[model samples]
Target: MADSTGKTDKDVAPQIQATDVQVEKRASDDESAEKGVFEHINLNKNISARIKNPLADLSPAQVLRDVEEFANEHGLVDVLPALKKGALVARDPDHYESVPDMTPEDLTTIDDEVTHKWRQPRRLYFTIILCSIGAAVQGWDQTGSNGANLSFPDALGIPEKDNPNAARNQWLVGVVNAGPYIASACLGCWLSDPVNNYFGRRGAIFGSAVFCFIAPIGSAVCQTWPQLFITRLLLGLGMGLKGSTIPIFCAENTPAAIRGGLVMSWQLWTAFGIFLGFCANLAVKDTGDISWRLQLGSAFIPAVPLLIGVYFCPESPRWYIKKQRIKEAFESLRALRNTELQAARDLYYIYSQIKVEREIAGDGNYVTRFIELFTIPRVRRATLASGTVMLAQQMCGINIVAFYSSTIFEKANATVTEALFASWGFGLVNFLFAFPAIFTIDTYGRRALLIFTFPQMAWTLLAAGFCFYIPTESRAHLACVALFVFLFAAFYSPGEGPVPFTYSAEVFPLSHREVGMSWAVATCLGWAAVLSITFPRMLAVMTPTGAFGFYAALNVTALVMIFLWVPETKQRTLEELDYIFAVPTRIHMRYQAFKVFPWWCQKYILRRNVTLEPLYKFDGVQTRGDNRAVKE
Candidate 1:
């Protein structure tokens, strides 16, 4: 039975399936070696992903020694016992009895963490709530301008309609509305990093609150378009700074399991602010020429609470750790977590992750770190992913309705009063729909919600546009348009509304987080400026049907980009994402197209029972048995 020179047939190797081969090559050092022969070959390949816990295999003695060294180096020798036990527990959260210096009380609280995960400390809730209130300032500003759009033109002697200069006035109106967005995109977002470095998160937030408070009052008093534009731009400075900082502040303070749900309060409170603006608009509709002024000035109301409340909250422990103040970091963590054990565990774990992060990102100046978001392999992937979601938020066209629903209704033959009511309905739907995301975003996950809702939003939006073709004389004309628009708001509130900011906040390594967020926020608000400026013309040229169809197509386009590029980060710690993003873009896209697409077709389309292959191998285990993706 010999085949080769002096070798028996028993020595011959058997053929392996491509799936088996890919699984086998998971440990290979070369990225190209992991590819199946028929798979797309990538010229610009990244290194292999190495996924493991840095402290998992350390013995109790080794854990003690590591803690001792960390404590000694950081001048924390006084709390060595707690540090040792915490280090051990962090290394094995599920297996804590074996950890030394353990108490019965500690065991009970740690056990309760699994059974009662939502029972977080009051200080933790308060911090997230107060910080998230900053988003109200942003939302109120947008809608105050929206409500003002109706009357500001006439007040400034530039009528938006029924005049010889109507076309020019529309563009001018668009420009005036676009001012805040432009200022935020260009200046306010870019200032986030330096501001955070100099003033810390609380200081930056307080400073932004001052601007949010003052700018709205200036907006209320302006007699000319130029003066109002100046005030709006000043509002942008605060909006950009607050918007960029608040989400990160929320993300850092929250537990990974509940992070997305908690952090999405940024969008939730924003919806609330929009609702309040509508109420204000209604309140002043009969006040002659002063209605728009009252609407614009009322935005300062949210800023009032934000300014007074920020200093009362606890600082982010990760921010403290980043500054190398381990003691203060410990104290901050204690306030945020359920127990001292939890605090110590976080302190040690975060410290470990940050050390690895520093090595990955390297020591660099702000400009250098900003460049690394594109240059470094891991960071570049995060940048591209976050940037896509941010850009997609604008492309989804919710802002079209948010900024101009009143005008859109008026154009559809409703009186000005009816239009205000319709805008308020859209705001109500937006705020109410967001509540479901708090329950579903963690369980159903970020990518699932996005994939599920994008198509729904597209069709609903398209339906609303087609309703514009309905006879203007019919009572059902405006009603149909309003119904579809409200439906679109419902679909949008849970998916694209919450995903963009939440996704962008968590993607980057801590080393580049502030700068990366600035980039992501700038991309969002920058495109928002373009949309705001162009939409007046889009309405004039394309009409409502054409604009709706246009953004509907973009919904599909955004879905494709999300499916191909953005990885799900639900329930994942910020540090754990380094491994997830390490898998190159080509590999992720190929798996989605070739593996997942086929499995989806079999399971959902053809009604056949099938198992989809898992993309991620976390903690050296290949997850199986109908577990939804933590996919690349």
Candidate 2:
């Protein structure tokens, strides 16, 4: 039978057997050589030979040229197969390349194994759960502060009802509460790279957990708004670290088939934390002075288990490989994967990619590494995609509802008690809608979801805004506003909510992942800071109707950006993305609608007679359907 690449079993089997015999003969010769009085000397020579690093001496361009020359001279179909069969090795004696187990059909088998092993092992599930809890703590902080803001004004002597300084106090409320995003944008973004590089993923998480644990207690006991603001700012630092680390940690560890959904658990648990925060508000809304403090302090509760549990989880195998702790990487992969073969295959892929990246990056410093994001075409495309998704996520106005829902409800003429309960309902809708993403994100793809749901979100925001034109005190108007808010959550939750985090996490190569994710998170927090600082003023000047209309316009802009730029990543291994982004911009945009629209329509609306395939594939040197091979 022919394999997926159309080579028959008979045509491939003998070559594989020949390669195996050659490898075995080499091993036998080496073993025979080591059995003499000169054995220790021979061993030392072998060790020295194996210690040389190919990437240290070669430029990326030179390496690429050498690989192409080697392939051509050997008449090889692909570099990987030759490398696997021991036909290709670095010229220097000290450079090492682990030969993967080979059959002539090994490539096809590897692809099949990757697909079959798509489901991660149970230990990986524990890692996902641990990272998800860190995300929940972040989520808890997001809406937990919203709840506390409601009562803290009264308890802390800030002006509210008829005070002349109410406008200033409102601005202060927005700014102080927005401190986390600001801190994340400024310090957390830059810190994430070095912290992850030096401390490892688990260590960074532990540090964040300590900050998360302590900051909330300060918020709980602070008697003054300034004290509370300082505590919240510190909390933002922890959040910034968690925001940068957890998604990368999760994405690096997961199988490609479920990577999107697993990374998106960050947002899923964020919504859950918001739900818990809203419930806390309802529980304490009627209590006297301590209500807000207790609500804010409750964010600390999840950090305990997060700190303890993360210690037991495996470090990212990719990170271990990057650090050249090959033994640890192997053990970690074994711990997280279904079988030893699968682990070996994963290691082979990671090792190959790391070699290429090291040659390309060339012992660059952090600043040089950051500059490479813009200088490298594939890396630049990924950075732009990640940054745009994050910006779109913040501009979608989800945070307006998340952070200011209680105030918005009150503005609609619901009593404080009624508004707190209504906020709970809003949080519930968000939490419930997030569940659909877990099932659909991998199957339906990230770009399609963003395209399909964005316009729906825009329309709901417009309708919700128009609802405010009804008399403020009318029960019908209040119900209409609440209904539209719930609809907005429904539309936003399944797509835009999770796609940003997943897309950002998966886009960067292992070499630049931490810095890339940090930049993406910084984009998210920077825009969030803009929204949080401005939403109160916008609400005052433009009315709720006009503010919602403005956000609706931003959603339309985001839709245009996504359509023009973002590529489908579903079912593609993270390594394959190098080729995906290499597709020229004009070609990608021209074909994007054909790729994204049919899938969205069939899955959500039509449900029949649709066949979907990846927009691009690499066959030997060629990109399928395109005449020219993609040169990397």
Candidate 3:
């Protein structure tokens, strides 16, 4: 400035220096601003590129991570958060815009809101409670038959202690007791898909409730073992339908956040039913002929409530969506969720997933669709996982305890009175331990629970078997066997008992959900049939110790299958699991063990600042196709 105005040389030099400093500062600021602009542009471009071709060279874990980061950068949240901030709203009366494409993370976020909302005492909980009443009937039917075994033989004119036809009588007992499972496996499983597809989840459940009512009444009136067997066979048809449909209903209607617990409530109530059955048996054990009849008839109580209540319950929104009854789906969702925004969000996610599924299915017939379970690698994996878990549940010998606990106690040298009371203890343990799963299942995840508990179950079964080696006259031996049996129940209730049903409910895609569940349930019934038919003979042949050992071996096998095959399904949307299983089997087989420990440590011990990136990656080609049809 001084140079231009013709000032002194010293003044001009100082002015020049100040000008230089200001110019340098301005240039540096310009450079930093340009750098920020470039960095932002790069980040946005990267995200867009990933979205455009999501499956291109990305692992399933990487895809999940990228989608989550994208949601965060865009200021996304789940249903509750969006609703509180007014980011989500119902469509205008005149014109409606389609919902935008959502990642599985976004879908799961919406599910979280619905779940949190349902946790309050609301219509959703009421529906779950009502639907679960059928499960109580199932439990009652199961243990009621076990209690009847105490006296039904004599009532049927079969010998009590020293019959020469003990083998034939044993066969009669097993066939009558397992008649339902046999019917379920052979006929009911085949019918489940068609029934659900034709009648919808609510209709299927209602029909089952009716059959449950009729079957138990028939059993109470039956005069012959053969007549009782036919009634049980009819009951099995009802059970098969309920088993396949109820879990699907609960899963489709409830929020994914609490879906595990709610669907698992089926098992919880089943435990309660077992408790009721034991109490009923205690009340009638001393009665001569009426004891067995009354025990069989008691099943009618829960069925009445189930039949009446399920009629008033909302149908699964997913079923409505599948039928393309979009308006009804929205209404059903609204009834189940807290707000219109939540319902809309859920509908958006569900619709997107259904579209993807239909595209894959391509107007296939029922037989073709059923065959797809095996032909499609991803779905086949799901089928295998579900079936294996069900098989494992049966083979672990929980039913052995459930069906013959009184006999087991007798074998342990307890009197009839003591055995009946001890049976009550077994039922109590089964009921009490199921509560922990209600709390921990969504938090700890399914795989972790299986891993932790399977080993414990194996140990307990083995110990119980070994305890039988001590003389039956030894009170200490009897006590040890009883303690081990109780411990087995404790481990099983929280893990295998509930996980199989819940996990199977979740694994299948909406397209094949009913059929897939049917197959899974069939596997359960098939195994149950084999065990029920053989266990009495097994008891006569192998004795209690050898039978327990066989169960222990099965548990060990189950543990291995779980470690190798099952993935962590916590906090994931049902659609997200498709990608998870799409990961190559070889990669999972190699890295599974190392992946297990860190996941457990992070959730249980680390508590903060834990990274789980390495646990999910492997050196393998990405098998998931570039199916970004939802984005369009």
Candidate 4:
């Protein structure tokens, strides 16, 4: 493929052979005599007829040269196959810098940025709407059971004061909530890559929808508490799928610019669902027989819409690209953006860049890729951070309120209506506060919010503990506890709630994202199960003062650990962070440089009051180097 220059394909091929770049050129480069090699690569027509301008205005030679050096340095050996020996030389024998034909190597320079966007994209308005709905469904499922517990005591024929099976029933409901998480944590990690590889993102959603429908009906009809318990467990399996798939689906469907906003919407809507469930509790008066059953069965309402709507929702474009379904990816991008083929060309170019990175990482398969996450130090750090956040979120004592607020309020001597209203208030605060994270997460960055929040939560809890310890059983003590609880939700809904999911999505290699998310969820569920099982007894044994104090202590410890360990992950695309972890460096420096700043600010620099545009997009390439280079 030599042209007038001395450049050759081999010179520009990726540092390694990549499996995804096989091109079926509909129109030959020679046929388009006036077009240059890079031009032909960008303009070639397909079924969707997309045309993109590459590193437009920059020399193809420079682009290819940069990509080659970058790949070689990064150990991206799989991309080498994309090159032909004469790609650069074939362009122009007279001009040594020329590139001939679109050597796949030339496209690898943007691999990190391209793949990260596709894998964890900036979501659209409609897609955000759907994910928010999904989050709401999760919230409903979690809180719906809480309301049922009130009417449930009679419906299940159990006595409040002397029921022998009370512990079992509590476990049944709580465990069912936990069951889905367990299955999702295990199965999600185990099967995420395979299911994603074979069925695409749409398939996982469809499967989740089907199971969601089945699980709710099973819960609606179960005659015995154990049967109800079993049904709940089954329900968890389905919800587990939703939990693991939702983030992946949202991340892949979105664009880089709006990635955090889209993903954080999951937490916001989860609060909305909880609030809705609390309202439902207020509406459903407990009749002696069927009150709890009907309330528990209410999950079917949202389940129906999700099942139907998901059938029509688009498959994730990133998943399409990963599967090497180019035309399908273009079609999805076209529908998502509602744009012409020109936009799709750029999308495919982005897809090509991602494909190169995936191949370089040698993660096209599910099994080995997943195992490699734990084996690799950088990925393990991410996995640990994700687990830490999940633990912090659970131990923050918010779930204690969601799951046991009524009990706690009742113990504090509030009337039933007061308790229910208090629960509603809790949900309201969570839902309202969640909205801020959608804006602040990418602006303030994950680390800053956490650094600010956890300490406040710690102080609030300590104050609440003191108020409880005071001799006066004054209304002010209850108010103090209430205030602390609200602050816990407010800080947590934004920082702890959303950041963990965002971190989970971005931290691992794409090949292992599913499993990594699974492991993270599993860790979350493990802690949740421990908390749920022990919470009743812990409260019984230690009383409210001790439990609040213990949780407060956990919060303080978590604040310290996060300050020391949790890396900031605000604006950096998944690709850029992967590379940062791939080598050793000051995590905070990389965090500050790429992950923390607002995107617009990073594009320009303040040099003595004169703004200068950065030469490179900060998507994946590091602006500075550090210690981990020693490993190489």
Show where candidate 4 strays beyond 4 Å. 1-58, 61-123, 151-160, 163-177, 186-191, 338-342, 345-349, 470-474, 585-632
lDDT of 1 by residue, 232-337 (tens): 9999999999888989988998888789999999999988888888888888888988999998998999888889999888887888888888888888888989
Model 3 residue 517 CA deviation in Å: 0.3
Model 2 TM-score, all chains together: 0.79
Q: Write the per-residue lDDT of candidate 3 for residues 24-111, one digit (tens) a residue.
A: 1111122233211101101101211111111222222332343344334333334333322112211110111222444455454443
Clashes of 1: 0
Whole-model Cα lDDT of every candidate shown, in order: 0.82, 0.74, 0.73, 0.59
Clashes of each: 0, 3, 0, 42
Clashing pairs in 3: none
Identify the runs in model 3 with alpha carbons over 4 angstroms from their true place. 1-121, 593-632
lDDT string for model 2 (458-480, tens) is 99999999999998766899899
List candidate 2 segments past 4 Å from native: 1-119, 593-615, 620-632
Extract clashing residue pairs from model 1.
none
Which candidate tops lDDT?
1
lDDT score, candidate 4, position 169: 53
What does candidate 3 score in Cα RMSD to the true structure? Answer: 14.9
Per-residue alpha-carbon lDDT of model 4 for 1-632, expressed as tens digits?
33224445455454223221233222222323333333222111111112222233224444455445533543433443232222232222123223444334433322323333333322356666665576665677666676666655555555344567766555554554455555555553355555666777667766666766677667767776667767766666666666677787777666554577778777887788888877776676445456566656776566666766765667777676566665566567656652332233334345444643453355545666666666655566677777778777777776777777766666665667776777778788888898888878866777777767887777776666666664446776566667777777777787777876666776665666777777776666667666765676666668887888888888888876676567666555464455334433244334445543444354444322333433223322222211112322
What would you estimate as the lDDT of candidate 3? Answer: 0.73
Name the lDDT of candidate 4. Answer: 0.59
Candidate 2 vs candidate 3: the lDDT winner is: 2
